[model samples]
Target: MRSVIDIVDLSTEELDDLIKVARDIIANPDKYAHVCDRKKLATLFFEPSTRTRLSFEAAMYELGGHVISVPDAGSSSASKGESVSDTARVVSCYADIIAMRHPKEGAAFVAASKATVPVINAGDGGHCHPTQTLADLLTIELEKNRLGNLTVGFCGDLKFGRTVHSLINALSRYEGNKFVLISPEELKLPSYVKKDAIKSKGIPYEQTTNLEEAMPKLDILYMTRVQRERFFNEEDYLRLKDSYILTPEKLRKAKPDLAILHPLPRVNEISVAVDDDPRACYFKQVENGKYMRMALILKLLKEAGTL
Candidate 1:
């Protein structure tokens, strides 16, 4: 009945509750093993993904739920011209919940409008990715001990980074959160996101091209790759891809406890040498993603009275 199309769809209180559930799941995995004993999760990914797709599947399996998936658009009826709404209607009969990703923005919205089951937007084009924001929130909370009263620096492809956009929207709701937007002028945070999510809420933010200048003040440093898929021209992708590579040298100016996060399948924006740093929490972000997703699944299923 209720579908999560954007990060703002869930209130701050709901976000906190989800984070609490995720932490409990982390502490006691066995307690939730059979929560979805006979439930089915349908993963309908029209776009290519590694982390989001596998994380959703892993979350379902860990909850004792079965998975029915369409791993790619080529193998799905969408390739044969079936609309996303029709696909959702069909999949609704087969699964208790749906996790969908599509290259087209608002594809999940279309699916949610038709599906009888609750729909979770896994990722939709360069638009919203609320689940990734959930993972990011859990990561920040665990690392920083609090989400508010901290400076969060978002680096790399901000314009096309759905994760970045979603996190800004979520964090702006919390008190005393300042945003440091670091990206090339061409890839700066969209004006609409700036106006609607940040400015309208009277949240303070700074725009910069220098990552090093923004480093020292940050409590959380989120790195995002310049997506090749989002770029229409290959030359633009190649030119901007290597813009901000986070190396040990870059972290020299950063805080000792700065939580480094990436909604990854990282394309070398982060140097491998930095992986051993105590501050590096991107892999932790990946693990947290599964837990947050598990929590979300439980909540949505319970809301739909499917659990």
Candidate 2:
């Protein structure tokens, strides 16, 4: 069975297909209501999550499928010291597909190695989050009508933002895509990511400490909160947490149609006042997440011959 452990696991063509399916589901929801009538989705989240877990469950239910979930690590067999592989093998026997999130990097890869069924990595620490990348791709496609030939600015927590890392990898594959990395020096995009995903591809990218200066040039502004959970040092977290706050005044110089996106659970990085602005598409990102997740579940299950 195939498994998705990183954003690179899917080719650009496959991503386009998934996006098309998501848009089709959006336009004709009723037609896809019972596509997974007898299937089952098991959500194994070892880390705390609200959006990814619920979005997966909601997607399955909307497809007329059932859900089995392990909401937390302590409540699962992991509490008894069960390995992720063992958990995946056990869950594979009971569910048609598995969606997993864990705080440990490469944890999903370990689970995918053992699971007999298709495994979808929901999120795995600061390593990668392919599903979030799917949601992002859908949002970008819908918002801009194309993924290429546009400048995308990523602000905040670049070091630990899995969503940022994943999206950067995905977008780098598209033609004429430029990156403007905005973050504090401590939170700059990892050198390996820059070398492998951007520099190696010969894609042009600029690093900046100033968000406003990069605003006018961006077609898309992806804002990320400095993740507290990823930090071992509470002091470091506190210091970088409020690094960049997007307000209406900040958007005055940004393109009128600039799509402002966030993989959220915001702790004041984005002003509530910006929510009413037409440029704010974070909520639309949330809704698109469900649809993209629904599209992903359908594709993986069909590939696994479960549907």
Best by lDDT: 1
In model 1, the Cα lDDT at residue 298 comes to: 98
Clashes of each: 0, 0
lDDT of each: 0.92, 0.91
Clashes counted in candidate 1 amount to: 0
In model 1, state the lDDT of residue 86: 93
Lowest summed lDDT over 10 consecutive residues: which window, candidate 1?
Answer: 70-79
Cα lDDT tens digits, model 1, 1-307, are 9999899899999999999999999999999999999999999988788889999999999999999986476475987899898999999999999999988999999999999999999988878899999999999999988889999999998997888888998999889999999997778999999999999999899999889899999999999886567677888777766658899999999999899999888778999999999999999999999999999999999999998
Q: Write the per-residue lDDT of candidate 2 for residues 122-236, one digit (tens) a residue.
A: 8888788898888888999999999999999999989978889889999999999999999977789999999999999999999998898999999999998865676778897
> In model 2, what lDDT does residue 298 have?
91
Residue pairs clashing, model 1: none
* Span of ten consecutive residues with least summed lDDT in model 2: 67-76
Best by TM-score: 2
Candidate 1: misplaced stretches above 4 Å? 71-73, 227-243
